[model samples]
Target: MIIDVLKNIARFLILSLLQVLVISHVPLGSHFVLLPYVLFILMLPFETPKIIVLFASFVLGLTMDAFYDTGGMHAAACVLMGFSRTHILKLISPREGYDNVMKPTVQYMGKTWFSTYALILIFIHHFVFFYLEVFGFSEFFSTLLRALGSTLATFVFIYIVQFLFYRNDKISI
Candidate 1:
């Protein structure tokens, strides 16, 4: 129990710092925003309580907001992602269902599943984020273009990071 807590804490700090300090600095043009910090929220254990997931996501987003001064844009998006996570998991759950200890990492679920999952969440997050940032639909196509651009970039970045960094969960079968 304690170990899991510590690991999550480490993940939060490391990812948050990397997001604020490093990833945020890598400008992918004006339209593309790299959002690798979200991987931390998306990779939480499948069995994690909903409240904890929502709370953690809020904290993570708020931390990024603190760095970027985007008010609660990230926090709102994080909470939206957290709210949608369980539904997405249910939609993609295996035929045998999930193990109590299962995590929604590419290392555990494979490329296709994780790709779909991540892309959907990223698109939703980016859509809300960009739209909310503008708070209007006057520049609909332009906002959408920016959101899509950032979504694709963030998704690719998260996918690569998962492959290179996250450990493959051992299957006991």
Candidate 2:
């Protein structure tokens, strides 16, 4: 328990720094924005309680909001993402059903399952975030395209993060 908490703390801090200091600077054209920070929220242990997950997601988004000066968009999107995670998990779960797995990871869930899982959540998150960032219908198509592009970019980044840093412990839930 203590170790998991510490790991989460470090993950939050490290990813936040990467988002604000590094990835945020890269020019992915005008429409797309890189929000690798959401990976922290997505990669959270599958069994994490909803309240804790939502709270952690909010803090993570707010941290980024503070850096990016994007009003409350990040916080709102993250809270929504956190809230939706369990439903998405339930939606995609196998018949054998996540009973043996402790958390979602490429190592435990396999590449395809992890990819689908990441893609769904990342698309939802980016869809909400980009729409909220621009918040109007006049630019709807443009915003939609931006959101789509960012979703793909963010998905790739999330996968890379998992590939490079994720550890598979195979804990029984």
Candidate 3:
């Protein structure tokens, strides 16, 4: 239990730092890089309450908003993603169902399911986030382009990062 708590805290800090790094445009075009905040949400113990997930997402978003000065756009997007998380899990749940030890990863959930799940959530997150940031419909094509491009960039970055650093043992939920 202590180890699990420590792990959770460490994950929060790492993700928060990643959020700042991505938003700060560290790699120039990296602002388009998908911050791996969603990974944190995905890593929570599978039995975590829905309300807690949403609340955590909102707080994470609000923290980002405070840093980025984008009002609550990030917060809103995070909450929406949190709200949709369970449904996505249900949709992709395996025939055997998610054992208590399962985690979201290429190895556990399989590449196709994991990719689809990540892609769908990432798209949803970027769409709501970029659009809300713009707060206007006039730049429809531009916003769509930004959303699609950014999603692709972020997705690739996240997948590569996870593949490199994600531990096989840690993957067991």
Q: Which candidate has the highest TM-score of all?
A: 1
Each model's number of backbone clashes?
A: 0, 0, 1
- Lowest-sum lDDT 10-residue window in model 3: 22-31
lDDT values for all models: 0.87, 0.84, 0.78
Write candidate 2's Cα lDDT for 1-173 as tens digits.
78888988998999999989999889989766788888888778777888999999899888989998999999999999998988898898877887534468877787888888888888888889888888876789898898889988888888877777765454443
lDDT by residue for model 3 over 1-173, one digit each (tens)? 56766887788778888778754555636236556666777666666778988998888889888878999999999899888988998887888787767767666666798789888888888889988988988889888888888888767867877677765555444
TM-score of each: 0.94, 0.92, 0.88
**Which digits, one per residue and each the tens of the lDDT, describe model 1 over residues 11-84?**
99999999888988897896998887888888888888989999998998899889989999989998898888
TM-score of 2: 0.92
- Residue pairs with backbone overlap in model 2: none
Instruction: After the best TM-score superposition of candidate 1, give how far the Cα of residue 95 lies from its true spot, in angstroms.
Output: 1.2
Which residue segments of model 1 deviate by more than 4 Å? 167-173
Q: Give candidate 3 misplaced runs (Cα > 4 Å).
A: 27-33, 170-173
